[model samples]
Target: VTGSPGAVITLDTTAGVVFQLNPQTFPALDMAGADDIHLRNLSGSEFSTSVNLVADITTLADGVTPIGNNKYFNLVIWGGQNRTGQTSHLYCNLPIGQYGKQGDAIVDAEKFSVHTIPNDFRGVGFLIGELTFQFSSGGGGTWALIQERVLLGHFPILIPGGGTTTIISTFVDSSFEIFGNLDDTKRIAFQADSITTGTTRIITMADVNVDLADIATNNAKVSNVTHTGDVTGATALTLDLNNLGTETSIASGDFLAMVDITDSGSEKITFDNLQANIVKTGALNSGSITSGFGNIDIGSSTIDAGTIDGTAVTATTQLVSNIWKDINALDVKAEYTGSQTGHADFDGTDDSVSIADREEYDGTGVF
Candidate 1:
């Protein structure tokens, strides 16, 4: 008989009742992914789904609720039904008992890593507090043939004062071992610690990897400093010393040197006596002189053979030596003038001639 919404169903035992157990598809539970689930009573008063559940859920019913939120009596949890075990793939919310209220079961004393499956019966078997387990038939009748089968079971655990325990199992207790992939495995390990005065003790994993881009923090100012790295592709760099007090000089061992110009069109170092410094250097690589300038000072400077490219060149010693050598080569002899002015006759011209007489006979021959 199908347990559909309008289907007839019956209750077992001597005190029988004919009614449905609300088989209207209790929405499936979700796997706990990076979260934890807290168990509480059926009133939904002190329950927390965070840090406990990993997926979206439908009904968070406590299987042990005795028709109401009565802590004294025991409760029953009829196995949820699904054709292909679709509804039972997620974990159940077990009660987290207090220190004094927790039972002697091993799973209750410590944190349990729970595994869930799609099957109605999970491989997990644990006892907490006063909760008990019982099996049922799909037809609402007694299935005595499968009574010896251990569908779910729990054992006692002796835990240390402060330690951790890991629980690893499949979702349902079944003889089938179809899951061979390690991705579907679940291990829920929990650690216990002692709390300080005002601080609550909790377990934390070290070395957490996080996406720093998601964090919103202060924008820090980075200082100007040289960073050391591999010297493979670094070709050029510039440095500005405008804020420095005095002139900075590069030391001998310093190989890399560069200067950055000011952005306001101002020169870094403006030399006033640029021409004077050029004169002191004596030789210019390639330069031109100013038009209508003073004398060219090639004085006592031994220029290279093919260095001078100008047309005219004159100097003190050069003028004196040339004039004296020409005058000394002239041959002069004695000569007589009109009355008695004895004169010396040069090789071709008169050596002695009166200043006034020479001017008077300028148009004619020499007198």
Candidate 2:
């Protein structure tokens, strides 16, 4: 059952309802790409960012109130899959959550993550299996699940891909394993000969990965911040990039965030330039700029602290962005005809470094 734009879906157990899906017409095999079930909620209240499919669900947040608003779930590869003796996972893409802002409309907790399948059953075939789910509130606790029988499918359509920065994220139970050779499951990928939005093809590496055993928060360009798991941090997958555009620097404070990680609080990677020409605002404020560290009320002198080690800065957490890291290995070579004017003004100042957030692997984990 898929709820389209302006559609409403409700689950009232008292109504004697059992949701059904189109059966697979192909051979029955575990994890085989056969028939799939799709359930989406374009407008269903009662649902929150997280849903617990372990119980009647009526007692968990939404009660019996509708719960799925702009949410979705997919039961893929529904056929002779022997998942009876194991557990499969379904990640939650509560992009806006119940707290998401639709166009200009606002709702508190409408994006329900946990969806009720009416009964503990799914698909139509001789190998149809039982389905169950649980909810997660990323604000705290464990929602990142891992090291088990998992079916990673049904990605959320909430990712805004039009702009320069495309955002896509999902929440899972604690200790979720992202890297490993799969056995009973296969990560089915959708291939696009020429993927484009409106009339333009996507191009560019916007941010860092969130689930690389580095932290739990979505990487919005962090360096070495440490966060051990949910509520604290997140892990991320590898970045899949190609033909992305290029960004260059050749002026003073041209790249904001050069040394200051403004989003994750006031975590600054400062640099001390003997020449006291300091900048205090904009993107190159912390890491991007090679010299300017932004000008602020620094004691009695608005000086240029542009030489301090600016390496300890970590990434800021984002809700709907997935984590993918850059590939940096020895012997990797590259070249670019950077614009002569594409650099931040050095102002003839030698810079010093000030690393922030104790390196994630430092002997002592202290910021």
Candidate 3:
């Protein structure tokens, strides 16, 4: 093909690769005929891109205005500002005739790519500042200019800032850029929203080695503990905060702390031995304890309401311990046995009773 005075021409062929001679071409090419193609805009009625797009981020901006305070990096601005007309495209060759249609937008249309800031702008070492943005695909017709947003990427790592700060974990349905710092000393700023509950979304936190003495029966938010959101489950950190130890003032009710689970009162929570100033009534002892007491388990002394089976019983002035007796030594008898009988009435002066069995009694109360 050859250049004309004021007219343009297009040539499309499928007879292998066409090589044009430098000195002179075949005949002056005429593309007006039905057998030829004309070069024109790749976009249709709606201007779609012709090839993959390159979006260079040069500056950071507080607001997208001409006079807005903008931070430029290597003469380029990021945050979708100052990058509209600075885009370049690497086009893909398309045989428009390959598909039966007149032309495929994607064939002539450009693919898109969100480019990172030039390595020169990243700097060698870390300089501390705050940075954040959200990224998403607007639609399929962003051809004239590359639209972009910020996301967590090669940017500087963010550190945990405020201890009382609270933020939604899930950013609705959009992209969430809650990237924390690489340092292990940092923690999350707030409760991250998990759209799902139970099994779907899981919120993770640092494990805590609990010191039981620090946790109180009513309040457990002592130490460096800070909870930004509600927690559920046995393995959650709340379990460690909950004080399972019993308190004397607890009014006939169960006590649950940060963790909802608690040991049932119906079950037994036994210890090696109970050593307290006031020996409170236990499950085995149905009666109430009125005075201060000493250790009951020590010195082989047993304390219980029912018949206890142990060594001996000793009582001090303020201490009273139950004497456990063996079941076999219990003195028990019926009112009357079938073979044995005793007189109902006794002589008033002598005060003696007659038994039908002569051999059953000794001379002291001879039958």
The segments of candidate 2 whose C-alpha lies over 4 angstroms from its true place after superposition are: 1-68, 75-367
> Sort by lDDT, best first: what order?
1, 2, 3
Clashes, model 1: 20
- Give the Å shift of residue 192 in candidate 3: 9.2
lDDT of 1: 0.28
Q: Candidate 1 at residue 37, lDDT?
A: 30
**Top model by TM-score, which number?**
3
TM-score to true structure, per model: 0.16, 0.15, 0.18
How displaced is residue 165 in candidate 1, in Å?
A: 31
- Looking at model 2, report the run of 10 residues with the lowest lDDT sum: 9-18
Please, what are the lDDT tens digits per residue for candidate 1 over residues 142-211?
2111111112222323321111245535322122123225742433333223346587555476788766
| CA lDDT scores, all candidates in order | 0.28, 0.26, 0.26
Query: Which one wins by TM-score: 1 or 2?
Result: 1
Would you give me the overall lDDT of model 2?
0.26
Q: Please identify model 1 stretches exceeding 4 Å from their true place.
A: 1-116, 121-219, 227-256, 262-367
